[model samples]
Target chain A: MQYQATVTIEQKAGMLDPEGTTAKRALGHLGYEVSSVKTAKLYEIVLEAESADIAQQKVDEMCQKLIANPIVHNYTIELKELN
Target chain B: MKIAIIQFGGTNCDLDVLHVLKDVLGLDAETVWYKQEDLTGFDGVVVPGGFSYGDYLRAGAIAARTPIMDSVKKLAAEGKPVLGICNGFQVLTEARLLEGALTTNEYPKFRCHWTNLRVEAVDTPFTSKFKKGELIRMPIAHMEGKFYAEEKTLAELDEKEQVVFRYVDGNGKVMDSANPNGSLENIAGIVNTSRNILGLMPHPERASESILGSDDGLRVFESMADYITENF
Candidate 1:
């Protein structure tokens, strides 16, 4: 079976988010009243697995190995079986 | 003595490093591709600056996982000197060869300019030629050069005296204005716990020659050479 996985990587809370701060500051310069903005990277991957459980496990391994840095980033993984 | 300058696809500073090592320091240096799995016969290794893989997925993250890093790690474990500059510094952090991460600059800019640094410790092989508290100037060109580490990590590094260089004013005082990228504690360079590996945001190769402004960076290479002669 083919499974599609999406991983969202985000900076940990309390860590400095320069990209978010810059976006918020830029919005303020444009007269918007946004308090803040946070940025993240989303990765969509398709792979072969026996079941959704296996797919999820694979995606989790991917996240732990490369997609996220435990020191600065947190990641969430979503998996779906493809027909 | 032979040294290897690990070259990734987007590495632009490999030649600069070769020039400094071969021409300036009189050492035999060769550029090794990232795919080469073995790093035997090299007494030292340098991960030169440049956007590896176009800085994709985060600067240095992908490059750090390449096969060559395994050999680099093995060599580092053997107590061989390894130096990483600029983007190479990012790779070192991503490889977990060094602690901390280099995040985006506080102002989120790709700053390229000469900055003054104070030598914090001289006991390490990388800075043995530098006098304690010596101030020198070097160029830094990177967007994500702000070094960030947890409080505990910072404390441990401080306690171990592993910090090698700190951004400072010409007068050697670490002022906020002198910090180009808002690195924690103005740290510009640091050594591993073993002190054999060094990673720094500054480009020592760019300053090895007198005509390129200041020749202060030469001492770093000189120190490494002296270390190889005495220890290896």
Candidate 2:
């Protein structure tokens, strides 16, 4: 089966995010009442796997090993079966 | 005194370190390509700074996973002194050889200037020549140089005396004004628990000679060289 894994990585809470801070400041300038903003990287990985469960495991390992830095970033993996 | 300077794609400071090691310090230094598997011929390893893999994904992510880093890891495991500078430091953290990660500065600017770093520990082979509380000046040029670790790990690092250098002012006072990147506890560099691996943002090779401003950074290289000879 073919699966598409969408991986979202972002800076962990309590850690400063410069880009998010900048965006929030900019939103304030635009007259929007924004309390906070956070930035994240979303990766859509398409791969072949035996099942959705296997795909989820593979994507999880990928996030741990390479896609996301475990020290400062949190990641979420969503798998969708493809034709 | 042969040292292996690992060079990955986009490693611009490899030759700068080479010049410091081979010409300035007069040590046998060579730039090893990122594909090389064996580093048995070298006594120490220096991971010079630059945007390896064009800073793809993260500053040092790609380079840390390259083949040569395994060889560098082997050398490090044998109790050899391994020093990482700037992007090299990023590589080390990404490789899990060192604790903490380098991220964008608090101000999110590419900082290029001189930094006054106080030696917090002298136990590491890289800082054996410097006195504790002594300040050294070195130039740092990078976009992402903020050192980040979880609170628990930060406390452990402090407990283990692994914090080697902290950013300080000209008067040697630790304050927020002196912290260029807003690192935790004003840390500019750190050594691992074993004290054999040291990582920092400053370009020590760029400050090796009097002509390059201060010779303060030279002591780091000198100390590493001295450590290799005495122990191995």
True contacts kept of each: 0.73, 0.93
Which candidate ranks first by TM-score, i.e. highest? 2
Question: For model 2, how does the per-residue alpha-carbon lDDT over B69-142 read when each residue is reduced to its tens digit?
Answer: 88888888899999999999999999999999998999999999999989999988998899999988999999
Q: Counting only residues 3 or more apart in sequence or on different chains, how many pairs clash (N, Cα, C under 3 Å) in candidate 2?
A: 0
Instruction: Please report how far candidate 1 places residue B137 from its true position, in Å.
Output: 1.0
Candidate 2 residue-wise lDDT at B16 = 90
Number of the predicted model whose lDDT against the real structure is largest: 1
Q: lDDT of each model, Cα atoms only?
A: 0.93, 0.92
Model 2 chain A scores worst on lDDT over the 10 consecutive residues at A9-18
How do the predictions measure up, each by TM-score? 0.97, 0.98
DockQ of each: 0.80, 0.91
lDDT of 1 by residue, B151-186 (tens): 999999999999999999989999999999999999
List clashing residue pairs in candidate 2: none
lDDT by residue for model 2 (A24-77), tens = 999999999788899999999999999899999999999898999988899998
